[model samples]
Target: MAMTQTQRYGVFAALALVMAATRIHLSLFHHDIWDASWGIFFLAGFWLRGSARWAFPLLMAEAVLIDYIVITNMGISFWSHYCVSAGYWFLIPAYGSLWMGGSWLAKRQRGLTLSTLGMAVAVLLVSEAACYVISNGSFYWLSSHVPTPKSFTAWFANLGDWYLPFLQTTALYAGLGAVLHVLTVQMARTSEHHGQMQN
Candidate 1:
């Protein structure tokens, strides 16, 4: 069955809240936790496939706003070490790849049958790999912070360093989100059925 309008709204709210809240949590404490920033975007693409046109750009802009506020409050200048080049805009394509992967997932998938679950895992792996590669690879090569050309192997090695964390974090959150979404929806269906039966 298709998601109801209300269910769609719930998902949108949950993802937006997770993105905002997770960033705050990470910013508050110094830790090696995986960054959920792009994970939110990745999931948003899959779960919010129909919402993509507005969702992607909105999330991108939201990220910029959050970064600005977070850095400013921390006494750091947004202009100083953040967004100092046109290369920063590379995030558009970097994140676009994730959105594309997710859109693909939505087109080819539905409920989590075993085969579908297998496909979902593959989608997550490939999507997050693309996410890390584009996001990190662009930063490494294009940013003024490291304005040096790297060999092909060296560039890939750098990608590897971040590949697992991005993949793992996104997979965890997206997986959990998918499961919870299914459960919540199932529970609602059951309640509705019981209500009709009681009547």
Candidate 2:
């Protein structure tokens, strides 16, 4: 469907809010639901377009806020949940890579062509790998009192166990969002056509 510019913006913004709330809820109360944080940021980059800059920053802030609330309420220290350090700030770039990948995909996603799908999958894989490495490496090297063996080898060995879950969750959410978007567009187009016919 040819969505009006305002309608498009509304849809994207609504999706972003929903994604943010879902991520926070899952992180706080239901860790078993799988995290959608990565996918949400990626979609913001792709769908928010001109607003991508502010959207990402806000999303990151929301994450920290929610984490703080969860930790305090649980009577736990945020630092105790994971080894944190100045290196933790690297999450900005880590998540940025995912956002950039999605933005790149958006440029090529005029349709659900095979080439586009292939490219999307490739971008998701690369983006997720980059995020995992940046985030994990930061903790392994910069964080104090890490439980992992003090070797790049040890970090690399356990990479898959940590990275795979993120990869799966991201792909699941992004793909689902894309499909729903397509359906929404189709429905809107159909409604417009029917209205015109009746006129």
- Each prediction's whole-model lDDT (CA): 0.74, 0.76
Candidate 2 local lDDT, residue 144: 77
Q: What is the lDDT of candidate 2?
A: 0.76
- Estimated TM-score per prediction? 0.85, 0.85
Off by over 4 Å in 1: 82-85, 147-149, 195-199
Which residue pairs show collisions in model 1?
Answer: none
Q: Write the per-residue lDDT of candidate 1 for residues 37-136, one digit (tens) a residue.
A: 7667767777788877777888888777777787788788776655445566777887777777777877887665677778777887787777667677
Query: Could you tell me which 10 consecutive residues in candidate 1 have the lowest summed lDDT?
Result: 79-88
